[model samples]
Target: MITINEAYVDSLALNAAAVKNGRDLVKKNKITKRCRTEDKTLLFGDCQGSGKEPYRCSVDYLKPESPVYRCTCPSRQFPCKHILGLLYASAAGQTFSVEAIPQEIAEKRDKADKREEKKKEAIGVGSDEAAVPKRKTNKAALAKKINAQLEGVELLDKLIRQLVQNGVAGIDSKVLKMMDDQAKQLGNFYVPGLQNELRELILLIKENKDSESLYTEAMDQLTYLHALLRKSRDYLTSRKQNPELAMDSESGLEESIGHAWQLSELRDYGRVQAHVELAQLAFRSNLYAARSEYVDEGLWMDLSSGSLYVTRHYRPVKAAKYMKEEDSVFDIVKASELFIYPGELNPRVRWDDGPLRSMQAEDLERIHSYSRSSFTEVIKLVKNQLKNPLSDKHPVVLLRYSEIVVGEDDSYGLLDAQGKQIVLQDTAYLAHATTHLLPLLTPELAANQAMLVLFEHELSSGRLIAQPLSLVTKREIIRFIY
Candidate 1:
């Protein structure tokens, strides 16, 4: 009777195997004799099991974000397959006849409601006198925690200053030991992001030892790390002075420096729930602490808001079963609404809910309009981001490149209508781009025509290097990340 607006079934399963098994059970008509509501606040069903008496499965959807599941089954897995099947069946639009709340279900709902009421009461919702003291206590505790974190930030600042003064060459012999010490210190301070950065720096140094551009790469990372430390310290100081200001703005620098926000906090602080289309998704592998780590980097475009969002999923490389297949990145996922996390110029988001759908012509047009920018505009944007010092990887659209030039040493450069050029940092990226863009050009077209491109770029030492996302000609768009 109740319309199911959202389904948390997929997210609730313990593992991928459980999800598949649960969905399989539902498809085989295993769940039968159910009761549901129009709001889908409650769902109970009988799922035929191996025994004669069916398993009684119930889901209390009173809290849509975190549904409570209960099933009379012997499965060790939480919720088990029956619970998943029931929820899946509801999400699939299978109608259930409205029925009176059974005695057992009614008791459980009443208990839940009472507990929530008590929680509100304990927070002094019914009495203003108790609320003031509770607020003060919470504020004091938060202040203490922030002050402790500030001490850690101060330590990090000192280490960064030393690194800058000594230079990469000075630390080359002891780089591994230095990184290990710094990472351990960062871990002590609960700065996981900085720790990860240190690990990445070590990996770069080790892998690129024989490369000609090793110094450039090392200095780039060191400078970025120094800037990050400075920004984090400044922000923490400001946050300490005005706690209210911290609540109002997104902690971009803080997050970049290893502060993490919970999913609940993100949901509450999100700016919008909008539909997004996937533009590019790739799996990048790297070494950390002598082990391989994998990260799924997904670039998504918000159709309504016209903003780009980055979604990342990280796992140990050894967990092959849990990792996404590289080729499967191109598979069409249904269009769904996402909770857009807060950011000033660029936002990050995660999937909220929706059915899978194919990208349409109108969707493409909207995305292009939102993302397209002239080369001059791109430069201006990068300049603005560079002002922050700690900001990295700003996505931009470069429109109408008059020429794609192959520079000395096989480097790639693109010239815009204004005669301004932006070069790519990687020679391989240039080779790949030339292969694709060259085929689309004829002798006359190569001489006179221009093409549009989308790229995520970084500013290093006053130079802008493009990391190509897509190359768009009059007839087709070829994505580089995929």
Candidate 2:
């Protein structure tokens, strides 16, 4: 059974209104109308704007269910809202008698329960043995995949450019066929995002829809892939190329924390960073903001000794004790491990707020660590920033009352500490979570920790590492005399 909160209900109602609006506009084009509703789920309808038949979809409201409405109305947007309204109506207090779970749903639930049980058992089984290695995708297989993707992307790019050059009327079934094939390839390869964009582009061209928006999005993707090609080549030859090749020309302290400075100007930024990136925290009962200049690209910090320096990614060491054997596959999830980039370059900050939101989850999991009180403190700081967003006085600066100990080689070290060295595992329970650290409670933090660490590949082992250099709180102080 799923519980619905009052706020969620209100949101659904609002969404339903939007869907209703969408339904009205879409129907104006004189397309066929269709409505659908699901038991314990959502409702939606659509009308054709093109010569084709109208598309309609709906999903039932079930626990942990995905988007209910699926449509082929040539819209890249999800749920197409006509469907959302019906679902919202159903959820916003309608009488639909409940019945026993369907056999298929019940069977799915049972299977899920069994899988969870196995995971738990593995966790408790202890480290008498390491689990089997996951299957690796071979290089030949990888090249073939990459090559296919390259072909699809190239074709899409060429199709759009050709459309822009020749005009919409010039488009023929052959061009449409090629675009459709590219879209299908992206979809088959699990790139629904690209697929959706391609669909939207096709519809826009066919209907003479918003030309400007389509052009902008298409260009954005084209530019991103172009840059990715260079980065991919650099990654392939990392051993031979200088480390600086991996870092973009945009690497610098000014660029790294520019967003942080912008945050200080806010009156109430809200947990934008939390919503945007990941952060590691230290537990602190006291409230304060901290600041420090970001020094260099791979400065290694001794978690035990409290020293900082540039270090490579693969400085082979044992896993943290808290790393359950079952969790070993996810190396980044290990708590309080420090790594640094040895080269002058900094890996670009990949933000979820935009396209190419994050790196591999396992990569992120490997660099994870928790603060005893830091997690709570960080969350509070973030929530405050999200809500307040601004202050008249200089933004708050937090300080570390203690040092963060790094777990390594059969031994432990205190990293980049300006205070007493303490073991984080002893102080706080590490969980798979993300956070942000900054000087302002009102302004959003620039970049949270995880990817900040993962972006910088470690040199020695050709693996990944995350290391913290320093902390400080920056504020523009003012004097008011009475």
Candidate 3:
């Protein structure tokens, strides 16, 4: 008879995430019929996934070193979570008595054995295998894309220069139509990212706000777009000369031109991290009128590495009613793998959903330990990143402070231990809702505490301002914005 333990079962799982999920199945009592054959060569059971119909799975260990795992699940992964869950049950000393193999499984094993025997006979037992051909990149296709993108960026540059020369005082209906038409043209050239930015400028004009504020918004949007275009065009030209020169690695310029990266590609570029633990510090849902989509943004902090990550779900405006929103999560999330996207500051992260438990005191301590205590240092970091026009203008962080103070003009600022002050203000797109919540907080909780803040740099005044999203006390977190 063979003996199975937790260590042995864990060692068998190549995908750590799958193993963790399998553990959850066991904890939920989803595994059933967990038993082994009298010969001790088989282990089998059933596990419920999303649907009520349980997936059937079995493991054949006639040759333990080369165990054969079978499952009815659609997953191509061997020893699917169902099988792992069954084995985990047994490893945890769950009851598994000697039993006969089911007739269906027995028949399947016989057929598999016959097929294996036929393959061995056809291959003539000890012959060396032929080397497989390595798949190569089609340089012609990639070069063509790079050329189209470069042309599109050049067109954008011409449009911006014209807008500057003519000025926006004449942004009437005729001018709006021309801008709209140009946005569509950019889309046709495969630079939809630029199209969205251009349409955003159009949307600002149509909002019919104060002229001065409109001019400021237009100037800022165009400046960022102009900088983004110049940087991406240079990157595309570099790829045009050397088609395989780490194209997507240049500050995610390729993605800016509408390249949707796959998880395998991110993993190949060493962007995926294993065993990531995150806490959702804040969340928000925003509508992008230009793109016709609603984006649900979740801000998460990595407790292990003290890193910030963001998760986004883009729902089309037409289908948004049918799609459920991913709202705030108060518990700590543990994920075996976190897929990292290309961006700066808070690069987007994604992970498979699973069961989560309520956070404990230890988790709170970890959050407090990772917070920034010095406003000066945090400002310096934000300034450095904001200097790059292409970088994220609004970056978020957790700030621990000695007290919250009111300025001479009734403005809010966070006071650190050394008396340095960081102003609190609203984000460009959001209202000052956090201000209303400030008065509601007790003085004891407001002093020597922490909060989740989104920092934005005022381009005209060069002042770094923050918007509080959530207030953290010793007991619980109060979120002003959802």
Candidate 4:
């Protein structure tokens, strides 16, 4: 009759530090029955991996003041998976009801009791059975899980090696398709972190232009994958040869410190290709006529190396209110240099136009529509605007701005100026929208040039949308703990 908080379960899922440790034990198969009774205790179960046979380990929560673990398993990793699983179970409100001991075990307990009784009688009635202790028994459940996990690592390693051998462009479509399927399988197994790592590797290779650098990176991933595979194989081999003997060993039941890996470390820049500026300006001139301010910036951070990259995505922000009857400070004038990226925050600018305190009703609508277009669409649209302010239905205008950089291996990432990294590797199709603002970019307005102007028109009114995009850098890579 122990009560567990639901929030604790959520914390367990999100807890970066704890999840790694817990996952390791799960992979090793050292945890079996996680019990949540009056005291959160773990009942040692059969182990199936490498270790001394007949391992004995249990968390005793019978006493809240001083909870302790009773285990014959050796090595000094305290409160191992047996304890962690028990806690997790309790937090999840999973009630533990001790099962009936099997007949054979019951008989053994009875015989032991008789022997202890006889000894107590020989000594004194008050004498206890302290001389006889519970014997350690081989665990069976854990071994099975360990064997399976090892197999998965092996398969993944082989797959990655094969992909690398095939070359970048060659493996691009096929490997990504395979990864998509593999990710689904891994997700079903509750190993999302592992899935993310694999995705990150694929993404890197996909985005790489240099075959040599890609091969090098692929080799590094191969190393890690191989190590994981080896560990799993070792665990499986131990269990198959002498399941009982291995379980009895302390190593069999105890949690192991995983191999040291630098998570979120980014490889060196492989290659860079300059963008081609279009020949003929397809944008209409009227697009920027009632405009105010525009800004777009890109930021990237490599988590492991503490590297950063910043790029810009620029677009004009339309004035809030455009009054057609009055003269305005802002006019249709093309600004230099524009870039675009995925994921950004709103960075809207506002200002006052000539003779008008705010924007007109019609001007506002035009500005709002301008704010909704995606960077690519916005740029082309703006170009059209600069060229012909009056032309409607531009070729690129109706073409749903839904194109993503095809076969991109490396998606953009972000890290704050403080070096905090956030990676967005598995990018799905980012649908075309009016305008989506990224957070990392700097707004185009400066001290001397205030573009976010509001023109007070007799009629038109609307709001302009702004967003900031940050460039990816080496330091913004996120690390994963195994």
Task: Give candidate 4's whole-model lDDT.
Answer: 0.34
lDDT of 3 by residue, 164-255 (tens): 78887877899899888898899877888888889889998999988888888898898988888988887888878886576465375666
Best of the candidates, lDDT: 3
lDDT of each: 0.61, 0.34, 0.79, 0.34
**True-structure lDDT of candidate 3:** 0.79
Residue-wise C-alpha lDDT for candidate 2, range 337-356, written one tens digit per residue:
12221112222221112111
Tens-digit per-residue lDDT, 296-344, candidate 4? 3222221122122232223444421211111112222111212211111
Give each prediction's root-mean-square deviation over alpha carbons. 7.4, 20.9, 10.3, 27.2
Task: Name every residue pair that clashes in candidate 1.
Answer: 1-38, 2-37, 2-38, 3-38, 334-356, 334-357, 335-357
Model 1 bad stretches (over 4 Å): 1-137, 172-175, 248-251, 263-270, 273-293, 316-338, 342-345, 371-373, 394-463, 471-478
Q: Judge candidate 4 at residue 194 and give its lDDT.
A: 44
Report the C-alpha displacement of residue 180, candidate 4, in angstroms. Answer: 2.6
lDDT, ranked from best to worst: 3, 1, 4, 2
Name model 4 segments beyond 4 Å from true. 1-138, 187-197, 207-210, 244-482
| Model 1 accuracy (lDDT, Cα) | 0.61
Model 3 TM-score, all chains together: 0.72
